[model samples]
Target: MTSHTWRLQPEGTAHDDRYDARADCHRRLRGPYTGLGTLLRSLVPDAHRARPELVAHHAVEILSAAPELKDLIGAGPQTLTSLAVPNERTRLYPAKRTRRLAHGIIEFLHGHARERGHALALRFDRVDEADHTDQEFLAILLRRALPDLVMVTVHTGGTDLIPELTTTLAAHATHTIAQHPDEHEDLTDNHKLALAYVESDGTSHDPAEQAAYRRVDAAERARLHDQRAAELRRSGDWSLCLGAIPYHLEHGSDREAAADAFLEAAEYLVSMGFYHSLLDVAGRGTALMDPAEEPRKYWMLGTKVTTALAILGRPEEAERRYIELRAMFDQPMLHIFSGYALAMLYTRYYPAEQKDHQLAKAHLNNVLAMASLLPDHDQRVFQSVFNRNGLALVELQLGNPTEALRLVSTGLADIDRELPAEKHRLHRSVLVHNRGRVYTALGRLEEALADIDTVIELDPNYPDYYFDRADVRRRMGDLPGALADYSESITFAAPFWEMHYNRADLRLELGDLAGAIADLGYVLELEPDELDARINLASLLREQDDAAGSLAQIEEGLRHHPGDARLLCARGLLALDAGADQAALRDFDLALNAEPDLVSALANRAALVLETGDHRTAVADLTRALAIEADNPDLLYNRGYVHQSAGDWESASRDYTAALLLPGADRADLLRHRAECHLALGDPTAHQADLAAAESAASSPNAAADPVRS
Candidate 1:
């Protein structure tokens, strides 16, 4: 048995071009799963030939999503049509797509593994420069793949990686620092070393090579950069435009070309929802040109920077940049862009106390005003509709559903009347989607469903439309319809944890317990620290009488979220079930200390204390629990029993009367308890009447026992 060692470079080393060029590249421009594509080629160079069934079954679908793989495996039929189309409006989130690619790669690896007697060792280099999608894929692979299949190592160049990947690596991988050999002898010829560095697309991490390159004169360095940029350009690799070209151009003498390349990369990243990458590229572009000299490019980059900032939840920074742009350029388009960005900041991204819908509306109004100043008629109309859609969101947040509906309707009407249906299809869908949300808020279920259905028809490949329709159906009490729509959404884009989480809830409602459990387990697989999913999974496991599984889930959730009141309460309930009364009581105390109003903890603690004959404490806990759930018949009945136990006849009578008024209350039990209380109070007439009522209720077929502390 021979063990294979594969020295992979996430951002390739000096000798590699394809992997280096693909670093930080947007998936839309180069297609997704490039990292997995490289891995597949390395692992099984003739995978299609070696494992035709596997390629036909698993690799084809992934290759369809990643066209770059077509050259490696030979292009096949478009099996996953939903993922094949590269529409910015209908694409899955980067994480979701990465998960799908990871699944396919795991399957491919497992298939390859069966032929090998020993596990392969994978060494990933320069992971710090890898794209977020690649990082996400690697993280998922590390977490989900069997350890016996592959041994993995990562080199991060002493830089901080994304938190999730870093955490996963910390837990699953051994940590070691690499010590480079002394290379001072190699720095003697600076010019030759610099040339070699440039030829390598500047991917060298050797200290001596870097020192030699820096020793070269600035003009010579610029010449080298220009040469490297030209070579990359002549390579005709589109991904190089995003990675090596922009980098070399920025360092070269061509400032204008650098700005252009950065702008192009930023736009691609924006379309791909790589907001963090967009911010970096847009910032570089903004630095290359002056707002006054090249106002269009400079402000275009500025707008992208601000938009990315807002989306990334740095609204304050976005607001400051927008203000600076507004001060520098008073152009109508700049104002319109800035105004909309500021409006969205307030409407969606700002902290709760800082959120001001009125201010957002004011900004949108300014945007609408600027729309009229546009020279082109189409531009004017499109800007008007776009800003009006934003205004609809602001109005919706402002608690004016009617106004929001009017705004969305007006925007849709403008699109229909003035613009061609094909011109702004994405924006048109957005307007209709907004109308659906407005309709949902107004309790117009049928109208909401109709609007969502229209959008789904218009853009059937978009997963969110199906998710929206599913929610609407769920709200309309159509569980089967909602479940079908949720399944459709999952089919279009798998590994979206929210869709799986929601589908689990619907499955539970439909009594598909196994399906619900599978969905929840999948959700946890995709997002381990999803607290709600963990809590729900634990509760469901408990319901299924899987005590060990339920306890394990609770412990895992507690590990992730220490002192979480809900998990603590759940743990307490598990303890109570296991007859660990003291442990249950302690957990209830801790949970209530964390959250005073946790009703489950209070109710369970009340039952435990009542069993211990602490009538005062039991009454107090039940009273507190009742405050949170005033209509709960169980709490009322339990409290009435506690008061009767403590010899408070009048209070017991009052509580029994209150419980009898609620639906599902045991009429005979309440009547009997109240009759005892009345007798204790020396009210013979009332006692006799209550006894008669209790006798009649007990004789009825609907009567049943209602135990205390139920």
Candidate 2:
């Protein structure tokens, strides 16, 4: 019991964080299944988390505001109530389901906190007032060994408890405290003082009273800002001094010092990912500098501002400023820097209509030339390798994967030559990962896996690396390995939908229809307009004899895409399964009308017509289907059935023999059917041989089953 920890504290309901945290956790675990693709349904729920690179890419979108970053953001505004994972839709053990939900929630929140560099605190402040189900959830959470999880519970006195919760608390209780009024009052006072000092006023306030009670008029407040700026300058903390610059400027405190602080702060913020703040400082800092006296300072501030604009997704403004900077500054380094930033805008973040890879390549080549002329050898090498990395990305965007891989490989070699082992570790990781991506695109799984393995060893915490490896393993046919990688990705980033979609596909391949269906359903929930997931789910349901479920799903899809040929074809399948032959025929007719070349609809309607003793109509349908798919065994076999029913033994036998020669042929069934045709034609020798072959085929361990494929 000591292995688990549980604490009971009674507090106001409004203060409880557990419910909100639990709700968020459930959403993460359940969100990805909304629009499952056929392939992704096989993975565990964890793989549903967002990959790290996508998240980083999204961060750029937020900082840059560039509307043209072409990537699937998510399944927007879809929900799980209308669609769900198969397990949730079906009846499951209450205890097991609850435990999974609870554990998944904990893991989801933990991963989120880890990625954002924050602490996770799960506080159930008034458990005694909660319902039995919630109480059970708390108990289950306490029982698990969650890493870095802070679990706190509150139980008010005189409240009834469920037996399981009572037993859980008795065994795992860590502490029970009776807080004193004076101690509580002192704690409240400290909180008030801290809030007043920071939130209420960070500068000049009345020193006659305690910090918490200090107040000031507008003039006094302005004086306080000036005073705080002076204090920060005296303290000599560059970072804090920079933070105070805005306040000092507003109060008209030391214009020269404030301008210096602005330049330093903007540079510092660039490294810390405060792109927006960098723009603010650079914008005002340039205005403060006298261009005639300090042209260099003005140029530096302008360049910084331009780069910030580029990174923030304002390519037009950045390009304009870059042109201005080039005209104003003669420094080669500034030109190279501007060229590099502009190149990235065209390569990675350009609007689709504005994409120009040739221009991007030209800019990158300019960087290469400028860097080659640098006095320092190490600096030149570093810049060259960096440009090569960008060029590799541009080649990838241009659909030259082999060229991309070659460039990235060359870049890595340059890094090895120029930088020490510790100096370019991050760049090395990126280069290896990029090379792996190219390998995956080339369908070279072994090489791809090797590169990804190296990447993971270098940076195991990155979720996207795991996602890349999972895809490589899937392509290699190592389903278990792929699934493991997907799970690892979820452990790092819990809001990714692609992982769920991929896992669902793997599960289907492994014959886990229930798991596959669940994943597909979840995918549909995530992406309601995902037609592939809808079709796959309906198809799987038909296999499970869930014709009504299959029909309902198809109908829902039809509502979204009225008269869609594919959905109509799927509906026809469901109607056939339900034994509504007339309705099936009508659906097939409608489907074929929507898409005249739909082979399945033609073949299936032919089979239905043959059953009605209309051989000529069936033959016409089969011939049309066969014309579209000449080697289709199912079409050939169905046509043979029509000929055999009409007493055309020679034609039937010829068609059956042709079907048997193809792959996925049902040998036992074909042989027996051919024997019937031979017997009808009075060919004793052929009939006897076919009968023997059928018997042997049925007796064999690798016996071919009947071709009942839809």
Which structure among the candidates has the greatest lDDT? Answer: 1
TM-score of each: 0.87, 0.54
Tens-digit lDDT track of model 1 for 1-710 = 11111233223333222331122223222323335444554555555667776665564445533434556666543222232323313222341444565665665665666656544556555566566656776777677656565555555665546787877776665565655554434447888888877765676656677878988999999999998889878866555666678888888998988988998877666655556657767887888997788998889889888877877778899999999998998777888878988998898889999999999999999889889879998788888988888898888887899998998898789878997666766677778888998999999999999999988877776677889888999999998999999988765553468888999999999999999999999889877889999999999999899989999999999988999999999999899889999999999999999999998899889889988999989999999999999998778888998999989998999999998998888899889899999999999999999999999999999886665452
> Which residue pairs of candidate 1 clash?
none
Given candidate 1, what's the lDDT at residue 362? 93
Q: Which ten residues in a row have the lowest lDDT in candidate 1?
A: 1-10
- Please list the residue runs of candidate 2 whose C-alpha ends up more than 4 Å from where it truly belongs after superposition: 1-376, 390-404, 441-446, 525-527, 555-565, 589-603, 609-631, 639-658, 670-700
Best by TM-score: 1
